[model samples]
Target chain A: MENNLKKVDIIFEDSDKCAPLKVLEKTLKRTADDIILDLIDSGLKGRGGAGFPTGLKWKFTRNETSDVKYVICNADEGEPGTFKDREILDRVPEKIFTGMAICGYVVGAKEGYIYLRGEYNFLLKGLLKKLSDFNAALKKLNVDFQIYFKSGSGAYVCGEESALFESMEGKRGEPRNKPPYPTVAGYNSKPTVINNVETLVYTTMICHMGPEKFKALGTSDSRGSKVFSVSGDTPIPGIYELELGMPLHDFVNEFGDGDTKAVQVGGASGHCVPRKKFNDTIIGFEGIPTGGSMMIFNSSRSMYNVLHDYLEFFAEESCGQCTPCRVGCQQLLKGIEAVKRGERPPAYLDDLKKLTGTMKIAAKCGLGQSVGNPFNSIIDNFREEIIY
Target chain B: MSTTEALVKELVEKNGRTRNSLMPVLQGIVQQEHFLSEEALICVAKELDLSAADVYGTASFYTFLDTVPRGKNIIRVCKTITCHMKGKDEVIKAISNALKIKVGETTHDNKFTLLSANCLGWCHKGPVMLINDEVFPELTPQKALEIVEEYAKK
Candidate 1:
């Protein structure tokens, strides 16, 4: 079995010379167009599960003609199994701030905000101190951009770009409709560039090491390495900067506890790949793209419990704006419980699967839409486990 | 002005009386008072020039914003999948037994509140608990009890 799993050392490397501020200084010298072009060339996608091309997002936001554009670093790391963003913020916070500043520069915005989740309130004091220093540095550079911290009040939906904007606006963190996307009308109904914390750090890294170096790693779709938050049923459970497009089999061999039966790629909203399908699966944009969450489950763990937990999470976390997600999540949870309780027949699981299918399209935001990914994947892979 | 009114006014002054300042204003009250009282909410609405219903609407949407009374120290145990798998039930049980109260209940002395939270983002170091702004991760039942006892002493 040939292993294509390659571990990269770019993300956590602590060299004082190639610091994030140095990257920002060099990036500031270049035109906005040049920076956007380099980002597009690198083929970097959003690391926050959505996989939208990072360069195109910046380009769109840059093209938008507005007087008061804004830059936001989405530090609301609420995804169940994904803890890499917090680790990034804890370790290389300047890199994130630099990325936001660079984005502000690219998109013609003077103000930037980091929407840190309330759960990570513990990180706030340290982040605020670092942010003040970074803001001072930006002022010394005559950049005119100052980053601010906005804390999310324990809402998972706020991780969604528009919901994050709403949360910042002191409203319910319900996602707004598209067409007026973040690129055009984000915070305060102005053109805004909102990116995940990791995405921002990668932008800083790309500026520092040239786009070609990042382009040299991973597949065509998923270029460069990503910081993965690997946990559950693994001996070495922690953050790993691994090259994307690696086969799940390779990941399992490297990180799994030998008895790994299934792996939850991404978070609870992501897919579940059984051990049998591990060889066929790829962990990248071209395959099962993740937000750097890979939770491995050993054979001893019950698939029913896993699916139940995910359903419960979605049901609780759903913003209740739409019926498909709000009603659908609760029904699915109830339907599974009834089946397990011997009230509903085993075939009733198919009806619940169909409900998730409806939720895929009917639900308003990603929270509702992607619920079926884990629901269907777990049910498909371990049907018997979900039933008696 | 009453203390709550003074607090709300100070928060409004610090954060501004804009609609955008509502969250921070509410958060400030929570930080000082532990939860948003009706008087605090009304005061914030008056200061921010919003209806009480509008203020409550936003506050109720967030899990962290407690509308009801909470203890001096909030003990939020992570009840997400990873935490559950890593013996969060036992940790919760330990805390419940220690505090002599179930989940979502505060101590009789109003010193600590025991509640279950969705996820605290420390999946690798599972069975985590957040005591107010601080976090305790990779917790055993005994470790959890010890931590709670220390808080109780304080």
Candidate 2:
């Protein structure tokens, strides 16, 4: 057996970079508007694949007039090869809870939900205990807040915001038609603001450091560092948190352990940058979202199987909603078979590419848009491996 | 919701009866046993004042917590992208040779059941062999004996 990646301390070196846990008790005095301003100034963006501005989502949700609003934490991270959220929830449980509490305050929501993924029983066990303790403290402090726990069906599709809302509402985890996103209308048709685990965790930091300091760390546009689950054929392949817009090549060598030929940023929905494009890419929203999953491929690795695995995940976890994703994912997986058999002509490849492009544009949500990424990346990068 | 007559009856037979009793019942019967027996799930549903579909839906959704009884020692072999590309077939061959069972089947002794999952979220550590969630990363045919010995000792 080969020695595996070691869990190291690359991210939290400046543990003092975070808001002190004691600050949560003081938050009861702050109003929702103040919290929103803090987040907006922080330039906080959604950490859950999309990288949409978190403060903008909150502003939209806050604009909706609903007394029965909700603040949902999309902790149901079913992204293939991603576990950065798991570590944050496991290690910094207080930050997530505090972030949720801040969301409850900012959005004027009476109720909050931490929709944890189903396989995370180990994680939930610890979180549940922390919630209990936090609740008792809150009750003593007379803070009017309540966050409930809802488990998911391990479907990667539920990672999408609207679909997660549907699951939280006790329905099948299928994507909802958008225009009125989670902000204007969400959970139970109520105005809801859904943020990623990291998004919420960072909220505490944003509030503490002030928005300008939070915005100063990463890039000119995107702000702050991101935690990524680095995987594949590498020497050290666990999670690493790096400043946004950090050079991809520097990252690959420093954290990726120098055995990478290609890299897939942003889990299943991410782009695969071949060695040729690796230097040109930066690890942020401007290029492609790292989305907590940074997967590397050594020269010895076969690209064909990687494409197949990602396509299969999309096929199974498409939430069977919106025909484009549900059917498109299946087509991509089956297309691999045709490519393997050399039955697909160059025209056939063009058709498949067109289909993926269609899914990216026309599909219901981020799940559909991101679903075609691996198919497009693999076909573009590794046609030789598919025939071999 | 709380437990019902069927639930209370089972609670007496197993755990206890009360409101908000699903988590404990799930812990007692499902997590410990690996899969909730039909009778156990029905009992849980009846106790929680919920439908069997609701119970089954809850049960099947999570990655952990199986619904049916599995073999004694669970062998979850990673068939994820990296593993597949790196000759997972060879690892599977070794697994099947050692256990004398194909993927998704249990041995005659019911001592081992092999599962082919997409990835254990550990693609970098390809061919991860988990004997009940204890990850054995970058596994090989030769390493099969280590698991064999561990199971034998157990």
Among the numbered candidates, top lDDT falls to 1
| Candidate 2 wrongly placed segments (more than 4 Å) | A1-19, A256-259, B1-29, B36-69, B72-75, B82-95, B109-112, B123-154
Over A188-278, each residue of candidate 2 has an lDDT whose tens digit, in order, gives: 7888888888888788767665778667677766677788787776778776776787667776766554667888887767888888786
**Model 1 lDDT per residue over A1-388, tens place:** 6778898988777799678888898999999999999999999999998989999999999998888999999999988999998999999899889999999999999999999999999999999999999999999999989999988889999999999999999999999889789998999999999899999988988998889999999998789999999888999999999998999999999999999999999999999999999999999988999999899999999999999999999999999999999999999999999999999999999998899899988888999999899989998989999887
lDDT of 2 by residue, B7-116 (tens): 43665355444323444456455434556777777776776668888867755654445776777777777676656765678888987887788987888877887887
TM-scores of the candidates in the order shown = 0.99, 0.84
Estimate candidate 1's alpha-carbon lDDT, on a 0 to 1 scale. Answer: 0.93
Give the range where candidate 2 chain A is weakest over 10 consecutive residues by summed lDDT.
A1-10
Docking class of 2: acceptable
Worst 10 residues of 2 chain B by lDDT: B15-24
Q: Please report how far candidate 2 places residue A261 from its true position, in Å.
A: 2.2
Cα RMSD (angstroms) for every candidate in the order listed: 0.8, 5.2
Model 1 regions more than 4 Å off: none
